[model samples]
Structures are given as structure tokens and as C-alpha cells.
Target: MFENATKQLRETVEAALPELNTVVGWRAGYDPLHMTPVFIKNAGDLSKLEWSPFCVQNLSGYLVKDPAVRAQDPSKKIGICVKGCDSRSLVALIQEKFIERNQIHVFGIPCRGTVDWRRVMKLGPLTGIQSARVEESRLVVEDANGGHTFALEDVLARKCLRCAHPNPVIHDVLIGEPVTPRVAVENSYGEVERMEEQSLEDRLGFWKKELDKCLRCYACRNACPLCVCQDRCIAETREPRWLTQRVGTSEKFLFHFIHALHLAGRCTECGECERACPMEIPVTLIKEKLNKITLELMSYEAGMDPEAVPPLLTFNPGETGL
Candidate 1:
């Protein structure tokens, strides 16, 4: 299925290349075991294109900085391939006026689930695993020793279990037949609910324990597609010094709080931040709490549609019953 999907995506790029300045997709990384986002300027480079569960990074973040591409250019466009979550980032980018709809061609893939390599590495030394293949009901893992079969659901990322949009909401070309939509589950925000019931002191203590593990690595921020404010980040600014450079518990807490607040109504709960955290902090809990608040109070979900304005950006004259 992935081979056919990649072939179709390659053909689309080939057809559209004359008018497109570049085609952005995942290429096999130098490590051979990983994939990295690649911008293909030549048709021959399409041979390097590949897709699999490992292709999890959101590539839409690059569109915001592609200076060579012009929205009005009749002879040029940028092509991007996106999974369900990545497509939402594109939608949010359009909604925020970061990019225009017609400026790029989108190739959408209906993701089943992606593996968390970190979790897989924790299973063992992985002495023999040469490659991984996803069968209908199981993952066929190959190693130097032999082949082992594991249930796909067992190794699937936690975020994928609660994902509601397995199929891309927007696409110029969809690569495969849509899979049955997984029933929307409530588990994504479960941790937040548990925390909310705790006493204020208990909640504070719980986060203190978690935040103490943080090394101030900034991996979470770097991995997030929506955290585009690189220049004005509170962590780096010195004039106001919202957060000190020291790696103390207070500084870590402040950093996490500021990060979560910045993404209060904007986070799409992609789990990129949590996944990227070296400390394995459940950073999604903070985002999920904000997500629940945004949904309940403002009646909004971020990145679902390009036309819907973000809750924080609009004001209702009658909001205060004035």
C-alpha cells in the first residue's frame, strides 16, 4: 500500500514539476534508519521520496519561509505531502495568513499510525532489527536474528490512538483509499482531567516533579510547527528576562507555562512537543487543558479549517453581554 502510494505521489510530482518550484517530501535519511524532510527541485530527485510510519515530522513548517516561491506566480508552485495532522498545520497556517491556499499543491496520505522509535528502542537493544513492515494486523519486524511479528496496535503511538482525523481534511491529491475512521476516544485529555481534580497544592507539586526533569533542551519548541516565533521567544530575550537562562526548577516551570500559554488556543494536539521532549514530560497535558478550555469557552478547534479564525484573534461585541 505504501509503495503504491509513494508511486502515485511521485507521478503527481512528475506531472506538476513543470509549474512547481519544488516538491517537499520525506527522503531516506543518511542514517538509513530514519527519514528527513527533503525539498526536491528536480524530477529525478523524486526517486528518493518514500513514505512510512517513520515519516512523522510535520513539513508544513517550511512553507512559511520559502522565499523563492510566489503565491501569484502562474508558472510556479510548491508541492507538499502531508499526513492527517500535518495537513491541519497547513490549514492553521492558511487561517493565520501565513500562506495562501493556491500557492502550494498538497499530497495527502491517510495515516494509520506511526511508531514511536523511542518506545521501540526501549523494548531492547534492537540487536537484530534490520527493518519494519506493517501487515494488515501486525508489524513484521526484521532483524539480524530473524523476523518477529508484533501487533501493530501494541506499538502504535499513544497520540494516534485518540486521533480523530486519520484522513486528510484537505488535499489536492489523496494517495490511498481512506481507512475506517477510528472511533473518537476521550483518552487524549485524560491526564489533564486527572490533574484538574487534584488540590491546587497537589497539582503544583505534580508539575514540579515533572518540570524538574527538564534540561531546558528546547526540543519541544523546536519540534512544534506552530511555535514560529523564534525571534521573540521568551526563553532567549534578555531585556525583560521572562525566564532566566539558569536550569533551575523555577525557570523550567516558567518556560513550560509560557510555552503552553502561547499555544493555548492554537495547539492542535499533534503530540510533537511531548514526543520531542528529552525528559519525557507529558507536555500534552498542558496543551490538552488549554484545548478543553478553548473548546468549552470559545467553541473552537484549532486547525480544522482555513476560514475559521482563531478564538484569540477575534472579539465579540456582545461577549461580555454589553
Candidate 2:
């Protein structure tokens, strides 16, 4: 499925090159099993673009966070690739008016899910990764030793286990056929529900234990496409310091709180924060809790509807139960 689509994508980008100054996509990193974000300016480099389960970065962040994309001449449009989760983020950006829809050419692809490298390492070491491929329900990995097939269910990212949207919500051109979600949305919030079922003290303990492992790397903040204030983030500011440089459990908790609160109704649950964390923390859970509140109190879901206003962003005197 991906084989044919990859060919089409290269052709499309080649054809669109004359009209675009840059095209953001993914390329193989140091290893065949790993992928990294790349920006292509020359047509000859279009062949470097690729599509695979390893293509996990939410490229939407570039649209707002990268000065180049923001400062580019409005007459020329930039092209970006989006998967199921990435597309929702693009819509959220559009809803927030961070970037106009006409400013980008979105290439959407239906995603099954992305693999968590850590999970894969649990199967074997990261060294000598020769190649990897996704077959229907399994992943075939070949390394220095030999080839091994692992059930996709065992190695997929946690967010993907409950993905509500497996197809792009917005796009100018779609790279592949729309895919059916691996899991239903009705039970998508099960992890959050399970956490809620825990005693309040247990919940507190859970976060405390997890956040204590934080290296204060800010990988989560950096990976977020929506965190536009990163350059002047309050976390690092002293005048009205919301968070300090000191490393402590209280500080870590506040840091996460600030991150969650800022993204409350805005987080599209792209799982970028969790994926980027070196500590392997479930950082997406923080945003999910806040997202659940907005869904319950205001009947809202971020990034699902570009035309709809966020409940917190607007004041509705007619709001019934506030």
C-alpha cells in the first residue's frame, strides 16, 4: 500500500516544486528504522522524501514554530505532509488563525500508527538496524542478528492504541486511501478513565513518580507544534516566573501544569510530547485530562472542527452550566 503511494508522493512534490519554495517531509535518519523531518528546496532532493510507519513527527509545528515558514512570502505556498494526528493539529492551527489555510499545501496520508522505538528495542537492541517493514498486523524487522516479526499491537505507540482519527482531517491532496481506525473512538479514553478510577492519592502518587524522573529537557515543549511562545516561554522568564530553573518535584509538577493548562482546549493529542520525552513519560496524559474536561463541560474537541471556536477562547454568557 505504502509502496505505490510513496511513488505518487515523489511525483507530486516534483510537479509542485516550481510553485513552492520549500516542501517539508520526512527522510531516513542514521538508521533505516528511524526517520527525521527535512525541508526540501531543490527538485533533485524531492526523491529523498519518504513515507513509512517510522514517519512520526507532526510536521504541523513547522508551519507556526519555524520562522522560515512564517516569514516566507505569502505569494508562494509551502507544502507539508500530515498523517492522521498531524492533520488535526493543522486544523487546530487554522482554527486559532495561526496560519491561514491558503498558506500551505497539505499532503495527507492515512496512518495505521507509528512504532515506539523503545518498544522495538525491548525486542532487541537499536544497533545495526538493517530494515523494517509493516505487514498488516505485524512488523518485520531485520537487524545484525536476523529477521524477527513482532505483532503490531505490541510495539505501536500508546496514543495510537486509542486513535480516534486515522485519516487527515484537512488536506489539499491525499497520498493514500483513507484508512479505518484500528480502535474505535468510543473506548478511546479508556486510559484516562482507568486513571480516574484510581484513588485520588494514587493518582497524585502516579504523577509524582513519573514527573520525578523528568530531566527538565523541555523535549516535550520543543516537539510541540503549538508551543509558539517557546522563544519567550514563561517557564524560563524571571519577571513573572511561572516556573523556575530549580529542579524539584513541585517545580516539575508546576511545569507540567503550566504546559497542560496552556494547551487545555488546544491540544490535539498528537502525542508529540510523549514521543519526544527521553524519560519515556506519558506526557500526553496531562493534556488528555484537560481535553476531557473541555469535552465534558463545553462539548468541545480540539482540532476536530476548524470552524468551531474553542470553549475557553470565547466567552458565552448563554453558557448553561458554567
Candidate with the greatest TM-score versus the true structure? 2
Off by over 4 Å in 2: none
Instruction: Give per-residue CA lDDT, model 1, range 228-302, as digits (tens).
Output: 786678788888878766778999999889999998888887788888887789887888898888877776778
Looking at model 1, residue 244 earns an lDDT score of 68
| C-alpha RMSD of each candidate structure in angstroms | 2.6, 1.3
For model 1, the run of ten residues with the poorest summed lDDT: 65-74
Error of 2 at 59 (Å): 0.6
lDDT of 2 by residue, 130-245 (tens): 98888888988888888888899999999998998999998888887898987655567888999999999999999999999998889999899888787787778888877767
| Candidate 2 global lDDT | 0.88
Q: Which pairs of residues collide in candidate 2?
A: none
Candidate 1: segments with Cα more than 4 A from true spot? 30-33, 65-75, 185-188, 320-322
TM-scores of the candidates are: 0.91, 0.97
